[model samples]
Target chain A: MATAGTADSGSTVPTGTSSIRRMAPAEMPGSSSTTQSMKKTIGHRGVETTTGETTYKKTTSSALKGAIQLGIAHTVGSLSQKAERDVLMQDFVVVESIFFPSEGSNLTPAHHYSDFRFKTYAPIAFRYFREMFGIRPDDYLYSLCNEPLIELSNPGASGSIFYVSSDDEFIIKTVQHKEAEFLQKLLPGYFMNINQNKRTLLPKFYGLYCVQAGGKNIRIVVMNNLLPRIVPMHLKYDLKGSTYKRRASLKEREKAVPTYKDLDFIQDLPEGLLLEADNFNALCKTIQRDCLLLQSFKIMDYSLLMGIHNLDQASRERERGGAASGDRVVLEGPVTPDQRRPQAQKSLYCTAMESIQGGR
Target chain B: MATAGTADSGSTVPTGTSSIRRMAPAEMPGSSSTTQSMKKTIGHRGVETTTGETTYKKTTSSALKGAIQLGIAHTVGSLSQKAERDVLMQDFVVVESIFFPSEGSNLTPAHHYSDFRFKTYAPIAFRYFREMFGIRPDDYLYSLCNEPLIELSNPGASGSIFYVSSDDEFIIKTVQHKEAEFLQKLLPGYFMNINQNKRTLLPKFYGLYCVQAGGKNIRIVVMNNLLPRIVPMHLKYDLKGSTYKRRASLKEREKAVPTYKDLDFIQDLPEGLLLEADNFNALCKTIQRDCLLLQSFKIMDYSLLMGIHNLDQASRERERGGAASGDRVVLEGPVTPDQRRPQAQKSLYCTAMESIQGGR
Candidate 1:
């Protein structure tokens, strides 16, 4: 919840400027006994500060968090486990992935099923994705709780939070309490979209979970991170196909690698995203079909997130004798040979990123 | 066409006993000049004798036959060509595979396309089949005229003929001239059935071709030979779900391995086809769904072709010291380690056959 002073403020306050006060358990009204150890209630980690940042610090409780995370991961994985083996029976099959309270565990209840909260509509389509796209169960399992989870602050919105996997492979999005229910209601149409169109540029959702945090159910959506880590982008743009109120704020533009908007992209590079003829045509065709599909679903306010990796920029950085050059400017194609690297994760997001130019 | 003398007879005659007289070209009106090189109008190799058995003779024309066969193979292959690479765009893309007249070609008046000729319904569903079932190009290319095509005689049907690939993998069925047109019309529904259900036990079709043979366009459907030569079945049944007029002819039953009808199966084995509980249940579920799909299409008079191999019978034959036993009774599974044999072909039909015997 936003504090009294932060609530009325139209813009987010920078860090260390807000009036944050730590209230004693006795002084705080309706405070639970467990709140004694919950440090600095006003602006603590996971607790949103006036800065609009909700930090995710790795605590000793991370192990427990990992277990909770995997519980949901395994549930989603099981949804499409035997998908390849039984395509016919799974059509009418409605198997729910539910988690109940364990005998001595403090975790609350949650459910994550295939069509309702996972990629592809049915188990068959999920199986198709697995078989065609080469997405294995191990990738989802490992990426969920592998090492340190990188917390990313939501720029403008307050209380909006997300965490990217350490490898930058997946993003765990925190949705509103009602958004989970809304997504469940939209499951059927979402499934139909997947069933009808084998190829789509839409986000490939892996699972959705309801985690009980601070005595409230927080909905989380696990999906492929639009910006991958293997090939870092020099510039990024989020085009909404509109010019009105599309420019990034001055503070946002001050970032080292800020995401530009439609207006900025048009003003900066008027030729549009210059791709190879074949690639450009293919991208346009896919975008058109995906747009029609979204339009059919009555969806609006979606943006085309484009990332550009300038190879020339990398070449210049290399000549400048930059430190950690190998790690920073490693220009490689998006299609990593999964066969050679057992750890390499394959997702539909890679296909979207493939349009990113290497040289031009 | 059946000769006048043979036409009246309801049953097939023995080869040596019939008049065996060839009608002259002068007697036949509208016969092509190419008929001059094609000997024996009444009966010959590939041409059915009164006995209704045609011998397949490998000839120098096999090369030319391969070319004509590739024309259709290439066409159907073209239908699902972009399937594997572009699953996304293929959803809305509609492409027709047409084979028109090329100058300096021996084949005259090329007009093999559309429902009256080729196969390709909703390219999306066909694309789905290609993508989901892993149907590849090499399956069609190699199966058509890969080796000396082995001609198989159609029992009791005088002019009906088919050829099994020399490898005995696929059957090039000589569909009736108009039947191809009918199938083309039903392509949309058929494609839908396949797209909707990935586990249907129905024949998996690879390609449809129209080859100019004997001065006429002969439409052939390339399908997995249900009675595969590699794993020979001692007993076979052609079970039409009906009872009336469904008995095999005396001449047909006289064959070493006759295709018994539903009546024969009930009389011979009243207990019904013995299968493991899981296998039976799985098979029943698939059959039920497939039947519904067929019913939706208003299709009737379809039969479930069943082939059973008695392993005990093979054991008994082996004990009896039968000659040339090496070529017969390969009880081993069809999935040989292909790493040892790089040329081994992989087709979706093999997967269909894998579900045949889960247990007894």
Candidate 2:
């Protein structure tokens, strides 16, 4: 988004320049990227990037023009509704603060979900910038927020204080409370419970605490806030409707869109999804971890079938035991044959990829 | 841990029938008070708790028998060694399991970071029990494991898991790498990173493959398999060595010998250290969840002139803004001369209570 491409270098523009490139403003001090694409019919903002070509654009006043286009009628409405003429108007302040300075990229949308759009600052990662904030996960600004509803000009960094709404009040985030809860404390405690810990069932302690925001309110939430556990629901190749057409014009592309109604859903998945060795290893770890927690929590019995590593054990203690990956153990629940598959698949378990087929 | 009088719930055994109590196994089950206490004691195995003015009874062959009766040792060296062995072995197995059996009160040594000692079985919340396993955290178990450790028992509603682990060479885990180059994928992409998480640092996602373990075999570690980023370093808490006492026996209590050396390197913490709120609402949530992790990880951010809560702006804004309870967020950074006084003692920086003299 930098203008000179070297915008941070503080390069200057020719004084009498009248091209689509930019120079820093004397008053407001803003400017960026030299758009060098061929121009056709331009929009209020800049050239609409319908095609894959870049458009050359003059930076000054461009952002302002774009904002005005969206609210031209509204601006004119506010101008006439003002009560005082002498004092600077509140309408001016609102317009100038947000609309005119359209330089922030954090506000850009990247993807669409049902009824909303998503703006990802980055692919979700370990210790995201959001964690740096003083807020709990449930109290984060975007947890349940719809992008189109909020007027956000900036994406706050991890520790940067931002406002969030919970129970209808705009509160700030300050703490994490996972380990403190009676039920949640085990999240961390279980990690140290075993040596050579192979598998554990208890979720780990992520963190705990409270967050303060919007001047003075604190919100609390348990953390290591769980992510959506996807269990692969369904998948299939989709080539239907107008999808077979190629070399379609933009108008034709828009008109002949294939919809979800055209797709099929699977009733259930097959058994023994264990494919590669890594997959088996992961399942073994999970089972071990699970058994460990079940024992600690008092819900399950130890089973040789749950061994995480057993390729060696199978050969040695062949009589006393079950399966093993290496030394890791796995729980051998009854294998639902093609006969039991119907009932079990009713539970709706599928492999990860199948579940992601067209994002079922 | 609570000082309550015992009610004979048809479970407490009479003095001479101690063997019957052992034979009965979970006769008394878990004490009820811990469930009501602020900090509930949870464990991998079951525990036997004494709630009220408890009658003391000792088991004969218990590995802990020697340590419990320091004076009755046949050979101080062998018995003490045996006791340590038994306790450690039992503890390892118990902690390694999945559920926390409602057990007798925690007989944890203050110096040891663990709170619950494995002894007998007890009750627990079942749904969370199932879900904890259903949505177990990945941070607790690493995939580089060569085998899965197996479980032996489950406490069920009664509590505690029965599992087996032997010094005999048995594979506890398993791993099968995809390739040698898979290890390269464990690190972060040029733009992505694993960053420090809870108990373990999130490994940079390299690649996935296989490794050789045992004699000739396969083992694997799925890199970047991180759960919600956790700050494990925050969970640690360091205390004076004097706090490391075993539950003082009646005779030892009478003798009143201070076994631990005084910490000349550190001093007695001020009374504020004793001000325990049921929940650390005043601290930022992330900081609190990481309270244990911080200590465990040694990621101390506090400076000499500052207190832990000072750096929390959200807490300050919360206090200045006001919401609930006595959890006031303290402000950090620069203060005016009016903020200080001549006759004052400091506590971990500028804690208000640290001032010896009250200021207007």
Candidate 3:
């Protein structure tokens, strides 16, 4: 989740020699080749890079990525066995610290050291989530974590990187220490709220870990991908219901899959979607309760991430043998008419039916 | 789930000439040496063999066992990919059917050629269960299923064979077609009930598959073992809440680890467990709801499987270095005083806190 404070106040795209200078690797220590390649790759794919290494280095998750991944693998593998199955209970979430001492090698400096520690706040509470969300450790460890990680050109606020698991079942995002601590503090209450009310549009948090590497305290949290795993969203919006700087920059708008904000959303759909009486009341009640929960926690500036997938357009595009990209993308496999009955109606995202009453 | 139709009326322990007649493998055209070996191995482990070849062959799961196992592996593997992640929904759950054509045999009669087919019912339901119960398919298909299937002389009703997964996380049992059909009919209702209530003492059902092999239709259902995975139960009772012929026979009791029934439980625990007012009320409500669910389905003669693990006696026996017998059994690893707080309270079987009153 990106913070509102991190968004650029004045949008200016860096390019040419300035971009090349920003892409230099040796300037930063412990920078992965993947991130270097990602900037150039996304640039070629026609997405402008805003946050450079200088700003990114201040709050980097790169150093902690490998360590957190290993820690998760080790903890999950150990806990998966019969002897330690119950060890995943609420209090038993803290594992022994994993330390990688400085090797004292010729090229490497002695001051550099890496250590990782992970804690599961109310793991038993999250176990309920594991049941409902299907984010089991096996799915993460075997199906996704075991494969090579792919770092993407993140659409999130600057200085943050997002890594999608090979199977795209889970997302690992770098969070500032303040956000991590806030989540850790809010977890128990968040869990209680979720346990009581199962219908909410809030993001599902899975695991949290902190890494001490490259003289930076990088905090990371693992969460279930908010986007539908099977259905590709043709359009996405990050709406905060606020007017101040609530529009995507021109550079962000250049991306094939840019996240539009509240102004753009309002401009496109002047008359909001109309719902049946009962459904409208239920949605209002859910939103009210969610707002109360957030208010109780004194949390603010959080946005409601929304996605829309046009089924008919997706089907027609597939029928025409069009390349899957942006509007033409089809994430889930082909579904026969019979397969798209009541089951499709049950999906959370499909409930966001956009009945565009009038155009912008 | 045990059915009333399968319970035996008589108390005789079928053995001697009857046992020899029952063990006649040549009489059964589709009998396998593998099944024979399994019986012998389990017998050597000190369990008696009352359900021999004659009764077992009549309701054989042998032909379908191999086929079902392979089908599950194939299904889980194929569906484990990213494209199929959402296939595990509330409604969709069947995997691809596996078929094996009959082949002419050289060792036996050509007229006895048998074909096999297997299909898993609503695998998505089981996938949800896998997430909740923490039983990963990889652990089964790779770690346990790849190992040789070891058949055990089931303490269950006669002629029913039981197989424990190599890792002992799951149990596989063969059922008669009638029982299988009854369970299939009950599943939707059963699932709905479980979805609403989490504290019910009902056994968790995982998968149900029917195999047409060995010229016989063998129905198999996989379920989570009720007994604690790590802790040993010195005494186990399968109480049907009925008195008619409910006690184990003399020969059955002669075994080291016999499954005592209703009469045995009553005879031993004349004064039942005492509970606090709130706990007693909650328990009564749970039992009442459970019975109503069963009655609505017109189901009868189900058992409440119980196991007793005396903490103090077990500790004392271990301290004295006693031989591992019924009284001296130890299964749960060393329990520190600190660990005895929440875990001890949460155990499904640990309500054996009847040490408050005088014991037998």
Against the true structure, candidate 1 reaches a TM-score of 0.48
Candidate 1 chain B worst ten-residue window by lDDT: B1-10
Q: How high is the lDDT of residue A170 in model 2?
A: 26
Q: Which regions of candidate 3 fall more than 4 Å away from where they truly are?
A: A1-360, B1-65, B82-95, B100-115, B155-158, B275-279, B320-322, B326-329, B332-360
TM-scores of chain A across candidates: 0.67, 0.22, 0.67
Candidate 3 per-residue lDDT, tens place, B115-146, comes to 55656766655665554444555664654357
Using DockQ as the measure, the top candidate is 1
Candidate 3 local lDDT, A165-242, one digit each (tens): 776546665555556656656654454445434555455566666666546555556665555335565666666679
Among the numbered candidates, top TM-score falls to: 1
Scored against the true structure, residue B299 in model 1 reaches a CA lDDT of 50
The order of the candidates by TM-score, greatest first, is 1, 3, 2
Return the lDDT, model 1, position B46.
45
Which lDDT values do the candidates have, in the order given?
0.47, 0.22, 0.48
Put down candidate 1 lDDT per residue, B100-153, tens digits, no spaces.
Answer: 343313422333322122233345544445444454456545656356676554
List, residue by residue over A284-324, the lDDT tens digit for candidate 1. 66667566755554555456666676666755666675343
In model 1, the clashing pairs are A199-B88
